[model samples]
Target: MREYIESQLARGRGYFTKEEALAELGLSAEAFQAAIGRVKRKGLLVSPRRGFYLILRPEDRQLGAPDPSRWIDPLMKHLGLDYRISLLRAAAFHGSSHQAAMIFQVIAPKQLPKIAVGRQRVDFLFQTSATFEEANNPAWLSKLKTEAGFAQIAGLELTLLDICRYFHKAAGINGAAQAVHDLGKNANPRILAKAASAYENSAVRRLGYFLERFGHNRQAESLKDFAKKAKSFKALDPAVKPLVAELGLLDEKNPDWMLIINVPVELEA
Candidate 1:
């Protein structure tokens, strides 16, 4: 079992499945389990998901496993799920590093629980198949080079929309604003408009508001038609409680984007 593992590592393959191990070692189920247990006890192997094992090299042994970006592509492929690195992580990759993400974030077609391997944590967010498919267009996604090859990640425009769409998870509205502010300098109005068309109107409205607030008037203007078409008003920050109603304060609305300002947005300098 150890020799097989060594050969796999030599070939630069850092992960394997239980079935592959059984086939390669020609061991009975009980024997295979015992052998795996022994290696795990030595801190040479760790499994983030059942049946899938990550082989830890000497350097990685301290972390208990390789970085998630190095192996996430293969892991997601093994699990038969289509995904992309998204939200704050993707935003950071696109030069919006004002707020570092504490956990890796992924967007998939279905809901999934957070994964913890060694010192790493991965949070999964869900999008409907249609929405995910639309946003996963090659134009909107990019290949992020990693040690293990590459992982799929959202482009700058998609990252902005995703941050607005999942503000609660990305950080609060202010964090989202900071990210928008940071990325605004390089933003393309047409591409931003194109990407916003793929998401829900609520997120588009919020994104437009942020773009305009941050002085990206051309980008903000590009989204005005789409925002105007939405018949209903959405809150600027969906996660915030309706303080205006509670305190009997006048409801503040941004007429151009048709968004209710339920909370004050202060961007990080």
Candidate 2:
């Protein structure tokens, strides 16, 4: 019964699955179909996905009305990304309140799976291990990093270094800028040094070169300096040297937030 569904949901986190319905309502196959059909048509429950449902109340979706956009969060939990809406997705979430929620930005390690939840695409990025300093700065970044598997929260400086390093791969330069400019001090250096020590490649050096440009007297600055001293990619890894050499370094100070490294224009910019 509707009263039973409400009573059952009232006790927990406001979500119920088909199995939950089976246990509570004891509906046979046809009865279950009719009950679900009635609730959904009345706009009292929303089907987030195939079997999972959320009690929409009067706030968002009407009861029983399935909103495909609501599928990403639960999907993320199922995949163990422990993801949050961050980066471009966060910006979009902030920027367009009325827009359809298709794309979700999240922060999880590289080990997580990539998924296209309905129309929204969920992506993943790898974060390096962080020291004590990087973890507590950006309220959002810190909280995001602490989400289950992606717990190595980097400081603002370390995050900036990472953004610059993976600007092209993770969120691109704009995402990198958003990661850095939104937060103030967490962009420290000592955290980045540890990252640099592990991220030995041309991509990292190019990012390090740019980040070293914006760096203050932080620990990552020293690490960036060391990364710049890598001379050529050949001295580092034999495999990535050629790719590193292709993306040249830029020393000119331009707030353009551009990637000076040369890649084909058709590449994901």
Each model's lDDT comes to: 0.85, 0.46
Ten-residue stretch with the least lDDT total in model 1: 241-250
Model 1 lDDT per residue over 9-74, tens place: 888788898888888889999999999999999888999888889999889877767878878898
The clash numbers for all candidates, in the given order, read 0, 17
Off by over 4 Å in 2: 62-75, 79-85, 89-103, 107-141, 144-171, 195-203, 225-269
True-structure lDDT of candidate 2: 0.46
Best by TM-score: 1
TM-score, model 1 to reference: 0.94
RMSD of each: 1.7, 8.1
Question: Tens digits of per-residue lDDT for model 2 on 1-269?
Answer: 58867785566435567776788788887888788889877766655456766565564442232232344445445444443344344433334232223434345543555544223355666553352223223442442321112322333444454445445543454455444444423344555554455444554554444444445335324544554455443221223436756654332222222223333212222
Best by lDDT: 1
